[model samples]
Every structure is written in C-alpha cells, then in structure tokens.
Target: PDILHQLVKGTFKDHLVEWVGKYLEQVHGKTGTKNILADIDQQIAAAPPFPGLWCFPDGHNFSQWTGDNSKALMKVYLSAIEGHIPDDVEHTFHAFLEFCYIVRQNVIMDQTLAELRDALAQFHQYQEIFRMTGVCFDFSLPHQHSMLHYDLLI
Candidate 1:
C-alpha cells in the first residue's frame, strides 16, 4: 500500500499533469499549460499520504484509478481553462487537494464504521459472559476514546 501510494503520488501524478497540460494546450492555447502543469505537479507531489487508518484494498481495480474522483479532478482542470472554474492554477490545484482530502476522510470514516460494527459483534458474542458475571470484561477505554476522536474528526 505504501509503495502504491508513492507510485500514485509520484508517477501517476506526473503523467496526469502532463495529460492535463496537453489537453489544456489543445483546447485552449499553449500559453499557460507549461506553468499550470508545473504547478500541478509540484502540488500533487507535495501533498501528504492518506491517513494510516485508511486501507486500500489489495487487488487490481481499474475504478480505483479511473473513478469519479479522477473525473472530477479533470473536470476542474478543464473548467478552469474554459473559465467556468477560477482560472488561477492554484484554484485548480486546490480542487485536487480537496478531492484528496475528501477521499481520505471517506476512507477513515468507512474504516471506523467497520471497526465499530466488529466491536458490536464481539459485544454480542460476550454478552452472555457479562450477564453471568454481572461485569463487562472489555475495557479498552483508550482505544474507544481514539475511535470517538476519529468519529468527531469525520
């Protein structure tokens, strides 16, 4: 996952920036594509990795590369060139940043929810024991609080 993230952050971003630059140059003029591409490449390369709790599934999934997130990023770049979105390169780059942030948040929330579900299942499994002893054995308070913090962050 770390290697995949690095590849996406480095090579994938580089290729996408080049592709978008060529697209803008063709649709609009070749006036600012170079600068825009450079800025986009720098921003993407500098962006932080996804949060640790977020797990990328292990397998080949084309949609992972070519999904609505990628489409929205392309749309934002095109819109900026066509004067629909703000034309500034920074504004277009911010769209990418926002997309990454959203993806990270969604991943974290999904993971947290899955964990909560598992915890509930375990609680159900141990309910009989608690009733017999009149006490709950599960006492991971710090872990529970961390999950609450994650919930609040989400």
Candidate 2:
C-alpha cells in the first residue's frame, strides 16, 4: 500500500508524463534514449491523462475487518502485501507501461492486442516474485533467460 502511494505520488504521475513526451518523439520519428529523454518535458505537461488504477479494489472485507488493541491481524496482512498491490492492477500497469515501452521501441511504434497481454504477464511475474520463499533468488540474468525458455504464452 505504501509503495502504491509512493508510486502514485512519485513515479506514475511523473513517468506517465515522461512517457507521453517519448510518444511525441516517436511520432516525430525520433530514435535513441537521448531523443526519448527529450520528451520528458512534454509528457509532464499533460497531467492525469491516463485511465484507472493499476491495482485491485480494496478487499471486500476492508471495512469489516478492524484491528483490535493488539492489531496483530492488521500487522500480518500489511506485512504480507509488502510493497505491491494485488496482481491484477500490477499487471495492468505493466501492460500499460510495456505498451509505452514497445511503442517507443521504434520510430513509429504501434500498440497491438498481443502487446497488452505481454505487459500484463510481465507485471504478473513481478508480483509472483514477492510470493516466493526459501529460494536462492537471482533476479538479473538467470531469471530472464529461464522465463524465455518456458513456453508460457504471455
């Protein structure tokens, strides 16, 4: 929840704007990271331009569940969530972010249905990582290579 809050205030608001600027650069047939960086200013100028939350609705029991003086249950649930929201929204945002990335990947990038699903899966794995336990975690190269090896259609 805190991560969500920080993202809302920090990255999401700013990144979306930066992404828009990149979009414009792509529209004008720009290339390279520096050219993409040029769009940051324009993207920031457009505020609240996107749609919907990138997380799930607060749980159905959110209101019904209240903490007692000990507040143990609240502590447990909060700890479990760590820094991420439910998989649904995370993946949605992943899709949205990926669409922005791939579109700008080319001088004249376009969005496709396949890309949308791929983005969702990208975020899904991101969320799944948090659920892992008792494993020697190496997030850099091995994970990326192994993910590709699986015939999982994302």
Candidate 3:
C-alpha cells in the first residue's frame, strides 16, 4: 500500500507538471517559453512535500478528513498559476484538485469505493478537456514498468 501510494503521488506530480507546461506552451506560445520552467518550479515548490496521507504523523492523523490538505494543495497550485492561464483552464484545474481530494482521503468500505468511482469519472472529464486542448501527458510509465517484472506487478 505504501508503495502504491508513492507511485500514485509521483504520477500525480509528473502529470501536473507536464499538463501545466504543455498548457502554457500552447496558450502563450513563444513569449511563454521563458516562464514555463519558472512556473513549473514555482508550482512544484508550493506543493506539499509529501502525499496527503504522509502529511500526517505516522499516517494516523485524520483531523482534516474533510480534505483540507487536498484543498490547501490545490490553493497552492492555483496561486502559483494565477493570471497565467485562462479561467476555463483554471476551473478544469479546480476539478482536478477535487479529484485529488477524493484520492487523498483515507476512508474505507462503500464510501471509499464511491469516491474512487467519482474520482475516475472526474479524471475522465479532465482528460477529455486536456485532449481537446492539446495538453498531452505520458502517465503510463508505471504501468509499463510494472508489467516488465513479475514481482513488481500491481
């Protein structure tokens, strides 16, 4: 579970950075080139040092179970990209954050399953938007590598 969590977290970070970089390049063109790396750096620097679960000591803290940590992380991403992207694009990011919130929550049983379902649905929607806007990302490395080794298969 810990390894899976780390994998998901790393994928999220990579996808987030790639998505933002591609979006900036597409929308801003040449003038945006110089700031792309800076923007990505800023956003990454602002993000939480660890996945939401690890933010809590010993992975036991549940006081912010309502997804405050996820929301805070989203706020940092939004603030970092302020005045740099379109409103609709920003809203898509908000939806992405909501998906992240669902994934970050530490719950079980029916609620967890339901949240996972919703998160998948939201991800599909966000993915569609990304596709339409030409914001490409390669988020399949983990799956590809996992299939290479029997023991690493998930």
Best by lDDT: 3
**Greater-lDDT candidate between 2 and 3:** 3
Q: Model 3, 1-154: lDDT tens per residue?
A: 3323332333334455456667777877867745665664455464556544223232212344233443334445565666776665566566556644554466555665565456545554555555668775443565323312312221
Query: Over 4 Å off in model 1, which ranges?
Result: 2-11, 35-154
Residue 68, model 2: lDDT of: 35
Q: How far is candidate 2 from the true structure (C-alpha RMSD, Å)?
A: 17.8
- Which ten residues in a row are the worst by lDDT in model 2? 69-78
- Stretches off by above 4 angstroms in model 3 are 1-9, 35-75, 87-92, 137-154
Candidate 2 local lDDT, residue 116: 42
lDDT of 1 at 19: 37
TM-score of each: 0.25, 0.22, 0.52
Q: Model 2, range 14-128, lDDT digits (tens) per residue?
A: 3322333343344444564344343332232322324431211322123442223112221122222223233533453454355334433433323453564476466445534
The worst-scoring run of ten residues by lDDT in candidate 1 lies at 53-62
Residue 121 CA displacement from its true place in model 2, Å: 12
